[model samples]
Each structure stands twice: as structure tokens, then as C-alpha cells.
Target: MAQNVKRRERDTAAAQVIAETFPPNVIDTLLAEAKETGTPIDGVDGLLNQMTKAVLERALRAEMTDHLGYESGDPSGNGSGNSRNGTSVKTVSTRNGPVDIEVPRDRNSTFEPMIVPKRARRIGNLDDTILSLYSRGMTTRDIEAHLREVYGVQASRELISNVTDVVVDEIKTWQSRPLDEVYPIMYVDGIRLRVKDNGVVSTKVAYLAIGVDTDGRKHALGCWIQDSEGAKFWQKVLADLRNRGVRDVLIVCCDGLTGLPDAVTAVFPDSIVQTCVVHVIRNAMRFVSYGDRKAVVKAMKDIYTAPTLEAAELGLAAFDTAFGARYPGAVDVWRHAWAEFIPFLDFPPELRKIVYTTNAIESINFQLRKITKNRGHFPDKDAAMKLLYLGLRNISSQRGGESGTGTHGWKVALNSLVNLFPGRLSF
Candidate 1:
């Protein structure tokens, strides 16, 4: 009798395992139908699509039950103040594709669905997915078709527009937000894009100021789009920056734009405006013949790489004799920018590299260019601002913009700055 009872227990355990492994789940029913009809299970009408729909539907029903305080077919729910109403069908986009799901409703109309909101046309990561594609130079139409073909989700152009439009408020808040009171070095530059102005398409410039604070991390202080680049506009931009915060700036590095030094000096009187050395070299290279280019570039290189101000001056005199007559325009360019250029040379070799070049801001321009490449023209400055802001938002999140750029050797450079200027880079 004991052996018979033990055999029965073993038999029951085996049956239970079989049931758990191959139960009457939605997939089983789907696969059974697929096998009998020999239909593929990866298409829009495939078993996988059906399974996603079923899972999401179950989640929606659960959300509704929680809100209504009863489960389906529960008799206790009848006398409750609010009861389950029939489900409503809504088309939603998923990573897998677009699926039509039934969202449960309540009789009192107070049931707010949290799993999938009533007004949400796209679910899950669809918003982020489309925004990412847009940031990588994909047009709305291209994004729309890509979703349909790759994920089997049909996203209308208007829906895509609305999804991206959500960033406008975020952009406004970020643009007007307060900034760090003191930055060790600031690199300012412009990224140009075509945007609509008063119904006419025009080229607009997005001027961005990137700062390296006391911690060696990179921060984009602000980005502003205007009809064109101008000193008056920049003065206002600088004033706006002052309004937000920025009590003191130790050094401002930039490609020399006429009147920019004055504009920055006006807002930050004590801030030294150091012209970017790389820009001077690139501009100087234009007039030299290909054969003489290397020689001219090397001689010009000697000026900035000099160990002392006297040595740099000697290098400049030598450069004048070698190539000044042949490329007088280039010579004049450097001579004019000499005052601002001299500030960077006063630093230690470690600190000079960080301040003498605009590498940080240039990398940011490359990022902004990719975002604006797909759009022929933005509807207006606000639209352009919104899209560019979203792109910056993504870049900052990826690079931890708040914590600074944290690039290699920056800590060593910051230490050099502190050593060179005693009280400039402290909290």
C-alpha cells in the first residue's frame, strides 16, 4: 500500500510539471493556430504581435480593476459606486509595431489609466525611440516610414510632430535657468542652421557658450538662435547670461569675431578674452601656397609654442621676415588679434592647452550639425531652438554635462590654472 501511494505521488508530480511546461497560455493557442494553417509568426499578423497585444491588454485590464476596485465577473462590484464599462479600442505604437489594444473604462468616467494613458498614442519607448532617430538626422517622414517598416508601427507625421513638440517647454526652462557663478574658462562659438523667419527661410546662428568650471567638467551655459550673428545680439546674449547668473568669469576663449572681446569685457570686465590659437592658424593657412604651407605653418606654430612672452615675440619677428610680405592679410589678422592672444601665453604649459584652443565647443558644434542636417529649414526660431535644445539635452545626459566633460588630463590642467592664478579658481 505504501509503494502504491508513493507511485501515485510521483505520477501527480510528473503531470504537474507537464502542465506547467505546456499550459493553455496565449502563445500555445497562437502557435497551435499557426501550425495548423502553416502561417508565419513574425509578420504584422503574426503570433508575436498577437502576444504583445495580449500582454498589454492584460496590463490595461489590471490597471482598470485597481481603479474600479473589482475584478472581471465579480458580483461584489455591482453595488460599487463605479463599475467596469466596456473596453475602448485605441491604436498604439510599440517597439515591435503598432497594435490596437482595448483599454478598460469605468462607468463613472473617473478611471484614469496609468498603464497606458487614454490620450497616449504611443506606448513604451516609442517617444524616446523617435526622438533619438530625429537627433541622428532622420526626417519626420523618414522616421514615420522607418517605424512602419521596421517595427510595423504606423506613426503619423502629426503624431511625430506632437511627440517632439513636448521638448519646447523643457527647452524654455533650461534656456532661462540660472548658471554657475564662476567659471574658470568659457569657450563661446556659433552653430549655423536655416530656420524660417516671418514666413521667409533664412540662415540662423545658434551661439553656444561652453564653460569649464572649477571642477574640470564641461558645461554648456546656454544656446541662443538669432537671425544672424552680430555683436549687438551677442551683447544681449551676454547680458542675459549675466541676468541668469555668471557673476565672475576668469577667462573667455573664442575664435576672434570683431567686437566680441568688447562685448565680453562689457559684461565680465575682469574676464580676460583670449582669442583661439587654432582659428588663427587655420585662417592664416589660406593664403600660403601648398608648397610653402608647411614652412609657414611651422613658423606660425613657433609663436604660440614659445616658452616665454619674450620668446613668443622673437618667434613673431622671425615669422614676419619669413612669410609676412607674401601673405600680408594673414599677417595683419594675427597682428590685430595679438592683444587677446597674449593672455593665453601667460599661463603654464598645462593650463595654456585648455585655454588656447576651442576643442570643447567645436565638438559640440559637430553634434548640433548632425541634428540640423535632415531638416531643410525649421518653421521658425522657436522650432529650431526646440530641436537643438533636445539634441543638447541628449548629449548632456550621455556625457553627464552637469558633472563637467571630465576629459583626460583636465584635472592636471585645472591644477596648473590654480597654481598660475592664486585666487581665480576656487569655490
Candidate 2:
């Protein structure tokens, strides 16, 4: 009798294991067999569901708490060291899956989570999805549809806007943050945006500043909106940068904004200003005939691509002799901007590439344009500024490093600046 009872208990345990492992159909079959034998298969679905949830919760909690350096019920507690507010755990429903998170509480109640915090009951993964989509140049409607189809979660346009807007304040603070005392190379440029004011939409300039540090890391200094580019506005921007701790900029690459070189000289008297060769060429090309564009561009290239300053001067003289009658204006622009244009000629080939153009800032403006492509026009200057600033922050945060080319050139240029300035510049 004891042998028979033990065998029956073993058989029952085996059946329970099978029910848990197999699909719903298999479990139903096992339940039917139990019913026929006047036995019960109770709480199987609920138990299995609870067990799965517990396992997932444990894994997620472990991941979240790993770097926190605290455990449950410790007297000193969670590295925060406040005992009055015990740790509160909250369950958030996310699109990827549900997660159990520990909410850190404090006496001041001012600890706002920069990553993911309590009261953010929606899925944390959704923010990542939106950011990813935004980076890939997706429109708001497209992002909304993607979230709906991929995650089976309904996210509204307004919600998406609000989520992206969270970066605005952060961007503001970053813009005003202290910068390194010396930047080897600084690139400045502007992109045009349509902004509405008093019910009229007009073009506004979005100015950008990109700095290359001593270690070859590229940093975006800040962005601002202005009616137009001029010496005065640029002086203000430079002053703000100086206030933010930029003691010296070695070489400033810019387009031909009149008096801009003077502005840089005024702010950082020792800094060299180089006009963008690309911009100068493009501006020159605009005055040439379409039929002669190819030849004209070739001549212009010779002027910038020459191996030395003397060779470049020879190339420019040849270009003037060749096209002076057909496009005298183009030749005159080169002559006028020659001072700014020729500064790059004084540098080594490695340094010339870094200081010859404002491509770094232009690349950043391209990204800004992509982010604002879908918007018809901003309502005001503030709206335009906010969007541009946030877009820049989003880009810088994702790319994680300087967004520029010619690192070797930047390093060489920086060394030259250090030699020229002696002790005034610091990294």
C-alpha cells in the first residue's frame, strides 16, 4: 500500500510539470484527463503567469539596482543615507514590457531622475524609441504610427512633443555651461529657418559654434537665433562664450560675414580668422555664368588647392587674368576677402584643412535643418530657438563626441596656437 501511494504522488508531480511546460492546448488535454479521474488541476494558469512575471521583475530590478550600491532594508541604506524616507518601489507599464522600479525618496523631495523616475508610469523604452526615430529623421506622425504598430501602444503627437521637449531645459543649461579655456579651432556659421512673428513668417538665422579641443574631441559650444549675422551680434555671442570661460580660440573659421573677422579680433585679439574657402568659392560661383561654371570652379580650386601661398597667389592671378572680363565680380570678391582667405595659407597643409572652412558648424546646421524639416514654420523667435537648441542637444548627446573631420589638422593647428600664445591659452 505504501509503494502504490508513493508512485501515485510521483505521477501527479510529473503531470503538474508537463502542464507548466507545454502550451495551452496541451494543458487543456491534461486538465481533461484529471477531470475524467475526478482529480483537480487548479490555479495552473494563474500560478504560471505569476511565476513568469516574478522572474522578469527580478531580472529587471537587478539590472536597475546594480550600480545603485544599496540593498533592501539596510540601516545606512542605498547610498543616499536618508532613513526617514524608505525606498518606494513602483511598477511601470512600458511598451517593451512591465518593469518594477525602486523609487529613491529623500527629505528634500527635489531629486528628479534624469534617466527615468517615479510617476513616469509609462514604459521607459518608449522614450528611447522616439529618440531613435527622431535621430533617423522621422516625422512626428511617422513616429506615432511606428509606436502604435511596433509596440501596440498608442502615443499621441502631443505626448511625443512633450517627451522631446524635456531636452530643452537641459540644452539651455548645457549651452550656458563653462567651456574649456582654450579651443584650438572654432567654426561658426548659420542656417536659415522660417519663424513666425506677429502672424508673419520670415527667415531667421540660426547661429552655431563648434569647437575642437586639444584632445581632438569636438564640442558644440552653443546656438542662438538672430535677425541677421553681423559684427555686433557675433560680438555678443563671443562675449557670452568668453563669459562661459573660453579664454582663447586659436583659429576661427567662418563664412564672409562682414566685420566678423574684426569681431573675433576684438574679443580674442590674438586669434586668427580664416574665411571658409568653400563659401568663398560658392559665392564667387554665383556671379559666373552657368556655361562657364565648371571652368570658373576649376580656377577657383587652383587658388585654394595650391601647394603654397605663393602658388595660390599665382593661381589667383591666373584666374583673374582668365575670367576677369567674363566675371570680374567673382575675382573682386576673392581680392576683397583675401586677408581672411590667405590666413589658412600661413598654416601647414595639415592645419590649413582644419582652418580653411566652417564645415564643422555647417554639418551641425544640416542636422538642425533635418530636425525642423517637418515643421512649416515656427510661431516666434523663441519657438525657433527652442527647437534648434533642443535638436543640437539631442545630436550632441547621441554622437557622444565632436562631430567634425580633420582631427590631425585640428591638433596641428592647436599646437601652432599654443606656440603663438605661449601661456595665455589653457586646455
Candidate 3:
């Protein structure tokens, strides 16, 4: 009964408190001012920050009054142990940019301001604002310039780098985390980033593995920057994936790289390697002569686009007779890669469309390029890796389903995979 009476008293006093705090013309005055200026009254360079400063200052004064048990300018404070000191000037960064405000202080340093606490350099949301920009591929230099021009804040390059460096710990944690046991298809590819290694600056390759689990959701397995591209390094990459908990992979799709098929088999011996036929066609077309290019491209499609491998072989032999004499190097390239190429032919058409090309990985590489294009070269391998990881994180945040789990095209691919491999997949 006592709790009920107290709750009723609080609910009834709420309106009385609001009436005492706000004037009837306050909203009207705001609307009239907005009409006269033709500019926004709330967001970005508006009266919002000024009003916020006024409210915070007022609250600080109230806190001081309560602390002293007397009102401002009252003689009652003479008996109190501590007295009011002059306000201190402090600037804090926020999502709305920077705001300079006066903070109240006490003579004995006993009063700890709560509105803008002591030693609080920035508002909580400001860090997230900086991180959002960094994830969208804005370089630290660009972020510094943006903060200055738009938010009226002078953020040093080091300050901006410091904000992004927080992610390095999260990245380390994510890389070693456990993965799904089985992935129906995995796309492996490398994107180039210019990095300084050991004293010399050169273009280095960063390897990425994108796995599509049974639920049709795509998981970015991991990304790593290697000193050089070699079979030994690739083997280590595969070993790392195995260590993370990838027990079975049905097919690994990749562009033509020397000895990569063997590398896949070395890691998951039962995993089928599907060399991108689209890459083969494009590379072969490069070797064909100009006048013959059109005729050669149409004929080349006949070999891989055929419904059956038997017919594809007949088309392959005809292609050899038709243009193999002139483009013998191209012919040899196809013949050498044929062992890896036929794996796609063995699968049904639904499955073939996926494993026959590295389109999945290529799309991801395109997204990474959007972020790295402005950078000429990173300071080191870790620097390059950080930028790429942020780019991937941003893309996932922007397009994943519900809680940002599955990508857009991945659902369609998973639906097809479900029909093709009914028993081997699990969400």
C-alpha cells in the first residue's frame, strides 16, 4: 500500500514538473525562428548544440546547489565546508562534431561533474562515428580531413589511427575463432595491395577464403597477407583453415593458379578442385588474333558451355583444328588445366554454375578494391590487412540478412546447393 501510494504520487507530479520546466510559447518560438531563417533548427550548425550547452550548464548549477544545500548567490554557503569555484573550459568531441562548454568546479575538487565527467575527452558515440567512416574505406588521412571540414574538429592523423587500431585486437580474435564443420562450396582468391616489406615496397597478395555453409549463408573464413605467392605459403594457409575446424569441403572454386589444385587436395584430400572455366576462356581469348577473336570466342564457349563432357570434348578437338595452329600456347594452357576443369562437368548444371567460376570471390575482391584504391601503399603488411578487414566488415554490416548473417546472392546459391547436395549440408 505504501509503494502504491508513492507510485501514484510520482505519476501525478510528472506533469506538474514538466509544466514548471517548459513555457507554452517555447515550441512556438522555435517554429517562428525556423520559418524566418529557412535553415534547420536542430541538426548540424543549428541551435541544438547551443541549447544542449545551456541545459548542461543549468544542470551543473543545480548539482552545485544540491551539493552545497544553498542556491547561487545565497549567503548560506558561508557555513558549508566547501564553496563554488569558477567554471573550467573543456571541449569534447561527439557524433554531432565538437562542442565547447564550461564545466563547473568546486574549491576543494570534491564535486565530480556528471553531465560531462572529468577527463572525458570525447562522447561515447564519437568513436563509433570514426569507426563507421574507417570501415567504409576512408583512409586515416581522409578521416582527419573530413572531421575538420564537417564537424569543425581538428583530429590529428595519429588520433584517427588510434581509433582504428582498436580493431586489431578484435581482428586477431576473429581469425582464430571456430568455423562451421562443413561448407558446401569455398571460393579462394587473392587481392593485391601495395605494402612495404623488409625495406622494399612492392605489390603483395592477400589471400581470402569465402565459405558457403549449408544454410546458404556466406562466411568470410579469413584473410591474410603473405610475403610472397608460393605453394608452400598456400599450404600453410590451408593448414590454418584445417586448424580452425573445417572438416569437409565439397568443392573449392578458384581461378587458374599454378599448383593450387594440388594444394587444395593436400589439405582436404577428398575436396574436388574446380578451376574457373570463365578464367580459362578469357585467358585463352587473349591469345587469339584480333579478326579471329570474335569467331574464336563463340567457338570457345561451345567447349565449356556444352551440356555434356563428351560433346564438350568433341567441341574441344574441333576448336584445336580450327584455331589451335595459330594459338597453340592457348591450346596447351587448356590441355594442361583440363584435369582440374572437368570437375565442374561432373556436377549437375545447378551445381556447375557455382563451382565453374570464381565469380563469388571476384565480387568480394571488387568490394575490397573500393576501400584500398585511394591508398598508394600501406606502411606494412599489418596495415594493409587492417584496411582490407575493415572493408569486408563494412560490407557485411551493410547487406547481411536480419542480424547481418547471410549475403544477398548467397541465399540463392544455397537454395540450389540444397537441392543438389541434400544430405551433405547442415546449417
Candidate 4:
């Protein structure tokens, strides 16, 4: 009984607030009409839909009257150079499905409707709906049919293409935007994409870089397409970064791409290039026998998890001693990457996680794969980049905002880097 009394008091307060918010009898009259006509108060083809159509039409009529400097049916419009010519029926997609309304016209064809512009078939958030679908790998034709089936709106394929094509310009601008002067760490990696070139389908590489800025924010720097991943191409990409205002980078974590370490040294001479520990382990596993794979991984973990650089070197020597005769190639892999592998061991665990691997960009590559998996091959380079740009934007948006600033445990990591690198990092 007491709980029921509290519920009733809450309900009474909400009703009082509603009554004070709207004018007298407005809510009651609308509810009564909805009941009298047996129409829903919300949803598509309901009272709200009817009211939206009515309101839009009435507002349009008011606009027409103002445009002509006279009221509807007023004698002052008789001699006016441009008078009401009647309305033409137009169906536009809206959040509440499609709305069919009559749009006013003028005699001289000079009065343009600002609310619903001429030749506009979509209003409000409908464009956003289409974009959201497109970013998820839906083709233009698929979006057109989806809009028709779900929203009861007939959108042409050309219209959908026009909407998605706008992202091309955005990609161009975002590709060349200036970069921050310093980033504590940057992750670089590449993903394969099938793209059509010269009327033949071929696999291409899309190089991506994700930078963790001063505030520990991760932002996707850029995407570059090439026939294959090579050190020369990476040199050009690094050059582009320098040109874009990246004066200093404390550390760059990347895979064991051949010559990548020398490339980093050439471009940002002060930056430490760390080979991805995860990649090194994975590469080493390929040379191990099926029966001994688990044991090999255990031995490898000791080297990476060691406390200090000297301890890590001892750990690597021990790993080589135990597995050296059985799997020389696996030991060779570690030896080849040893220079790049030892940098993270110098830092504490807080900073070690930031430079341990290229997993930061690897997660992004996974999402881009999911978005592009449906297509057998993109039509062209531009189409692939456009979709990629949109997919990155969508991923960033879902994470809360662009770059998703204030990475978890970032404050602790930043403090460590400041003391370790001294003047390199700017807060």
C-alpha cells in the first residue's frame, strides 16, 4: 500500500508538470481526438505523423504568404507581380517515415522554399540514416531499396550515390590536414583490400597510422594505398608526416617490416622504433613444430616479460640455448629484430604497454575489414578510400567522439614518458 502511494504521488507530479508545460486543454484535446478517431498517438501513420504533415504544410503556406507580401485570398495579391500559383505534391523522407505534403509555388517561379528546398527529396535526419547505412558496407542500390522497404520512401539509386559521394571531398581534406607537433607514440600497420585497376581486380595494401597524442588520445592519422608494402613507400609516407608538422615522435611501434627501422631513423632520427613484440612472437611460432609450439611460446614470453634490458637479453640468450638447435629460424627471427625489440624493456610496465605492439591500429584494421568484407572488390581507389574514411569516422563516433580522448591508463603512461624522455614530450 505504501509503495502504491509513492507511485501515485510520482505520477501526479509528472502530470502536473505536463499540464503546466503545454497550453490549456491542448494535450487533452489531442488525446481525446486520438481516442475518438482510434488513431495511434505516435509511430508512422499515426497522430504525430498527421500533425507533422499539417504543421509543415501550414508553415509552407505561411512562407508563401510572406514571400508574396500578402495573406492567402487577400485582395492585395491581385496586382502583385508574383502571387500564389497553387501547391505541388512532394513526397520527402523524414524521421517519421515519408511525408507527402503540398508545397506552395509562385507565379514567376522565383520564390524558393527554404524549409524544403527545391529538388530536395529528403528532410531532417533522413540523410543521416542513409549515411549510417552506407558506412556499414551497404551499397547505393541496397540503401535505396532499404529506404523504400523500411521508411516507405522511394529513393533513386542516383540520389543515394549523390549522398555517399560527398564523402570523397571529406577524405581529400582529412588526408592532408596538419598534424600535431608531437605524439608520444604512433602505431603503423597495413591491411589488404581488393581494388579494381585497369579493368582487372588486384589486391592492394592500405597503410594506416594511429597516433597517441599528448592527452593520450588515439587518432587515425591517414590511409595510403599502394600495390604492396615496401620500405620505399613507407619513406614517402613518413616524409608526408614530417611535412604535415610532426616535428617529434617519442616512439613508433610497428611490425617487423623490412628496412622500416632504417626508414624511421632517416625521418625522425630522435624517435625510438620498437618492433611489435606480438608480431615477433607470432613470426617465431611459424617456424616451430606443431608439437612444440606451446612450449616455444612459453620460452619466448620470458624474454619479453623480463624486468630490465639486461635481464631481457639474458632471457633471449637462454631461449636461444634451449631452442637454438631445434628451431634455428625462430631464434634467427628474434636475433634479426633484437635491436627494435629491446626498447620497450627499458620503460616501466605503464609505458611498456603503449609501445608493446601495433595492436592500436590492428584493432582499427579489424573494424575496416568487417566493413569491407561484403564487397568482392571496390570499383576504384577513390571508392575504397571513401568507404574507409566513413568507416573510421563511424568507429570513432561509436567510441564517443573523434580520437576518443583520455585513453584508459593514459595519465599514468604519460607521466612515465615525461620523466624517461625529458624534453621530447610536450604536455
Candidate 5:
């Protein structure tokens, strides 16, 4: 009898301890202690799971009540209660965790979220990771490994491709968006890429036009892919520019592209087309011997660095006299391109500094090449366009400022133009 009484007392003590340890206040205290100690509680993962489930359930219930005009939980005490349409919720497994999301019901049933709307499934931090990788020029396989190692989540190439495909429509819209009326200066250039065409690989040219508006902000006008670039195709491009709202371009800087000057003249009658002096020099040097290149370059510099058109002409005469026999082709190129080169000289020195070269477009192309460094070659025109568009989009946000010495010179030159053509120039 004595032993039995002792055992009952021991059982009572154990029951009291269990009741005290699991009280609401005790659980709160334990949670605070775990937080302070930076430790996970034993067997608390299940508790966390339950808590998350309950929170999600409550949220879904509220959404259904608000949107479907139906109350959740128990009905009125009467056997029959107000009837309403019921909505179904689905559980979606995601990289972060599992979530219960409500499905939308509409008459059309074709609503697709472009930017990932709320209550979406199979979407989480993975999308952000993929986009970040893409911006940094990571390929699909690289992104797959990165996610596998960082989040212990395996992502397939098709999934990554689909995620990136969301930007295609956006790129199309941006390509067709209306441009500003008057760009103070416009830079035109082409970048070449190897793409598969008709089941055979070939080289294709991608033309890009970048413009700086009157307000000093840079804008990417658009991009086009073609088998080649020439006057006729470029005329179409110019007409497209007009249709897209580019009314006036005061100056256009470009390389020695065939028929380009005529095309520009046809579109913007008042615009001055300046052939890039740097391209002229590069073309000139090709005709000179390696041993005489240094001397030839020195002579070329005199032609560009001359203070006035007459000075430049004198320099050119001297250059032809010195190197004509050795590099007749080089001198002829200069003479042939001189009409385009001399337009900048008609403007003030400040204006000449900006329009004398196509360096602005070249700088942007350099960044583009960096983005395409690892791409051996594109499979098709669409693939090449996609990569270039992504790079442009990433760089587009940084469009608020002038980039180089040329830009500084442009500011001064534009101010002078504004004073000279007050009615024509608008900021």
C-alpha cells in the first residue's frame, strides 16, 4: 500500500511538469530563448510546418470570402444555410516551400501573368536567381549548377528558357515604342554574328541605332537583323524611324557605309552626315607598309586635328604628297570620304569634337561584345536578337548621363546649336 501511494505521487509530479512546459506562455518563452541563442528547437520543424499551413489556410479563406462572396467555416445552426459558389485551392510545390494558392476562374480562362502575379505556383526565389544569372551573361547550364549548389534545387534548361522567354513580348513592345522627335546627335553602326540560316550557318549583320535626345539622355532607337546592310535597307530603317516619331536629327555619325549618307539626307533633309574620322584612319592605315605605318598615322592625324577646313585641306595635300606613291589607296580613301568628313568642320570646335567620330556607338558595342563573349555563335537570328536585347535592357536603365569626353563636348556644342538655331532646336 505504501509503495503504491509513492508511485501515484511520482505520476502526479510528472503530469504537472508536462502541463507547465506546454502552456502558451511557455511556448512563447521557448521561442524567445531559441531566437536569443540562435538555435533551432528539437522537433520544432513539424510545429513550424503546421503553423505555416494554418496561416496559409487562413489567408486563402479570407481571399475566398472577399472575392467569391462566400463565408468559410461552419454554416448557420439551421440545417439549410445561404448557398454560394465554392472555389478550389491547389497546393504548389516551390523551391522555397510548399504553398496553397487559389485558382482563378474567368469566362475566357486565358489570363496569363507576364510578370508573375500573386498566388502563382512553381515560382519563388528561383526566378530571381535565373534573371540575375542571365544579366551576368551566364548560360543555361551555369545557372542550373548555381541553383543546385546554392538552393539544393535542380532546375532544367527548359525551365530556365521558359523563365527567360517571358521577356520576348516585352522586347517586342520596347522595339516598337515611339522615339523622341529630335535627337541632338545619332550614332549608327552594325555588329556581325554567325547565325544558322536555312539549315546552313552564315554570317549576319545586326544594325543598331543609338540616339541622344535633346535632354542629354541616351536611348537605344532599335535593332534590326539582315543578310547585309546597304543604302536601300537603310532607307527602310530611316522610314521606320520616321514612322516611330523621329522627326529631326541634327547630326548623324557613322562609318563609311555604302549609300548611308544619301539615305540620311533623304530622311532628314537638314541633317549633317559625318563619316567617322577614326574609321577613315583605320581604313587608311591598311594600305601602308608596317615600317611606314607610324609616319602615315602621323600624317593622318594632321588631317583630323587641323583647326579649320582650309588647314585640314592643306594637311591632306601634304599627306598625299608625302605618301601618295606608297599608299595611294589610303590617300584616295581620304579624298573620297572628305566631303562627309568636312561637314563637322563647318560647326564650332565644340560640335566638331562630338561629330568627328563614331566612338559613342563603338563604346556601346564594346559592352555588347563582352556580353556575347562566351556565346560561340547564335543558332538563329532570334537567338542573337534575344541575347542582344537582354544586354540592352540591362544597360538601358543607365541611360541618364553622358558617357565620355565626346559627350562633354556635345553639351557645349548643343548649347551653341540652340543659340544658332533657336527655332529649330528644342530641349
Candidate 6:
């Protein structure tokens, strides 16, 4: 009896390791079937379905044997009360197609199969399929139609919603999770989306923050939904980051939102606030004509790309002289943002590139925009937050599983940052 138990344990362990190479005989049989039937090997009635059925049935059989503590027809099981009671036919939907297989039963009726649960009608990681589709911005109705048409599975809208609803709690936990003690670089920005409230649709801003750790790997700190972006709301966001364990941030990159720089320094006095150069340029361009835009852009590049802070100021002066009269507002933008913008001019190119703009976070916002474009307007705040959270998680996976980006030339950038901020950047 003990030997039988040990052998069963060995079998279970072996079954857990999926074989990379299948038996040659099985392949030959499948090929022969396809040739004889003149069917594609990967179609509904093809090798995948056959293999899925065989693997599921085999797993069920193994489960039954484990449950009974003895193999079929073993004399040691002659007096065992919970003996095999054969199997019942069960049809399950899979990615390939519908597969009908046998589910083993026990005499005592306690054999619960894990591969295909007692009532599970569909298989092949369907929840993941729904999430992948949902993260890619598909509506639940769209996902339902996609499953039904592509996989021949009749999934209801409610079922699809329930699958994605699991992300709500995940978002809550992720938002409040503890962060690293210090981040080398941080970028914050807002993207607008519509949400419904009290039967009225209003535009709301989704504020996102991305932090680059000491290792130079980017981590999406969190997302916040607000009626509008302001320093008061940003103070709250910064406080939350502090409460969650972020002690110091070397630099905070953001747009020229009024009082935003004060909010950053208020929360982390040691942190330098760097206004995004791209935002400054865009704001300046807003007041320029299409014809003069090229010349203006060229002049503006001289200021930002200057080798020294004094040189950049000279470049800005040169720009003011050339276009200041016609595009005074454009020149004023540079003048207003000059203090926050010149910080990059003091750094080497490697470090400057890392902190010059909030482009890293903007890329993430672009992806979220794509996800929410079809949404029109979310029914409520949580609905909007849930979808955005899932979208970020999906985006992170696509960019090599990091919350932000594994920036190219990160090693060189880190070395430059280390030399620039003596005691600030600790591993």
C-alpha cells in the first residue's frame, strides 16, 4: 500500500512537468488522420483539439487514480471503498474549438477534476483571454462577440464584465502599495478623459506618475482621477507618495502647471523640479504661425540644446530678438519657464536626456488614450480608474514587464546622474 502511494506521488510529479517532445507515434497518428480527412492540422477537427482532449482526459484519469489512492485494476484496490465508477462525457469549449472528453467519476462521487472543473464548460485560460482583450480597449460586448465568433464560445456580456471586474480590487491594492525609498527621476502628467456623473458627462483629468529607480528601471508610481489638474490635487498626490514610503526624489519632471513646482518642493524639499522642455516648446508653438513655426522651432532648439546655461540664455535672447515682436506670447512662455527649464542645461547630455521631458509618461498616456477612446465616457469614476489601471498593467507587460521603460543607455545615464548628484543617489 505504501509502495502504491509512493508510485502515485511520482506519477503526479511527472505529470506536472509538461513534456516538450511528444511521442513519435502520437504525431504519426495525428498526421495520418489529417491526410486521410484532407483537413488542416490546426483546424477545429485538427491535431490541437485531439491533443487537448487526450491531455484533459488523461489528467482526469490521473486525478481519479490519485483520489482513490490506487491505479485502475490493481488488486490492492479490490476492497477499496471509493473505487472507479467510469467516466461521463463532457463537452468543453477551447481556443481551438469544442472538445468532447470523458470526465472520470468515483463510486463515492467525490472525484473533483482540476483540469476541467465539475461545471466548467470552457477551457484554455479564458479569463486571461478576456483580460488581454479588455486591456487592449475592447468593450465587454466586443469581447463577447470576439469569443463567440473566433473561439465558438458563447460568452455573455455579464460574464465578460465579471471577469474584468476582478481588476478593480487589484487596482485599489496597487495604488496604495509601498514604493521605494528614493527614485532617481520622476515624471508626472495628466491626460483628459470623459466620465459620467449624475447624468451629466464632464471631462476629467487622469494624473499619472512614472518614477525611475536607482537601477534606472522605470516604475509607474500610480494614477489619480481629478476634475482638473491643480497644485492642490498634486500636493495630495505627492503626500500619498510620501506616505507610501517615497522619502526622496532626485528630480521631478513635469509641465508648467501653475504652482506645481512649489508642490513638488513642498513634499520633497530636496527634489529639483524640472519643467518638461517639450511642454515648454508646445506652449510656445501654440502662439506661433504655421509659416514661422519652423524658424521658431529651430531658434528654440538653440536654447534647450545649448552647451551651457549662459549659452542657453543667450540663445533665448537671440530668439527674443528674432521673433519676440510678432510672437511675444511665445517668447514670454520661454521667459516664464526659463528658471525650471535651465536645470537640464547644467547636466551632461546623458543626464539631460533622462530629465528633459515627461515623454516616458506621455507614451503611457497615449496608450491609455487608445484604450479609452472607444469608451466614450465611463459610467463612473471607478470604472474609468479600473480600465486605466488594467491598461497600464498591460502596457507594462508589453514594454518588458517594467512599469515604465527599460531606457536605452540607462547605464551611461546612471553614471552621469551619480556624478551629478553626489550623495543623493544611493543604491
- Write down the lDDT of every candidate, Cα atoms only: 0.81, 0.72, 0.77, 0.85, 0.72, 0.85
> What is the Cα-based lDDT of residue 25 in candidate 4?
86
Per-residue lDDT for 147-173 in model 4, tens only? 878767778888887888877777777
lDDT tens digits, residue span 1-427, model 1: 1222454588699679757755789447868888898867776666666777987898888888888777889998888888887988898777767788888888889988877877887776688788878766688899999998888887889988888887777777777888888888889988888887778988878889998777777888898877665678879988988899888788889988666788887888888899999988888888788999888888988899988888989988899988888988778778888998888778887788687789889988898898788889988887787777777766876676346567567878877777766786657
Tens digits of per-residue lDDT for model 3, 1-427: 1222454588679658766776778857866787798756544556666565676678778888887778878897886878888898888776555677788778898888776778877763577678878877888888889887777677888988888898898789778988888988888888888898778899888888988777666778999887666678778888888899988888888886656677777888878888889888888877887889888888888888878889888888988998899999778768877888877776766567667777777888898988788888999988888888777776765556212245445566666666765676776
Decide which is better by TM-score, 1 or 4: 4
TM-score for all predictions? 0.86, 0.70, 0.82, 0.88, 0.75, 0.87
Assess candidate 5 and give its lDDT.
0.72
Ranking by lDDT: 6, 4, 1, 3, 5, 2
Error of 3 at 287 (Å): 1.3
Which runs of model 6 end up more than 4 angstroms from their true locations?
A: 1-21, 70-88, 307-314
Worst 10 residues of 6 by lDDT: 1-10
- Report RMSD (Å) for each prediction in the order shown: 10.1, 13.5, 7.4, 7.2, 14.1, 5.8
Model 5 lDDT tens row, 113-148: 332344554543457567657756788888888776
Better of 3 and 5 by TM-score: 3
Clashes of 6: 0
User: Best TM-score goes to which candidate?
Assistant: 4
**Over 4 Å off, model 1:** 1-43, 46-48, 105-110
Error of 2 at 284 (Å): 1.4
Pick by lDDT: which candidate is best? 6
- Candidate 2 lDDT over residue span 134-164, tens digit each: 6555767888898767555567888887776
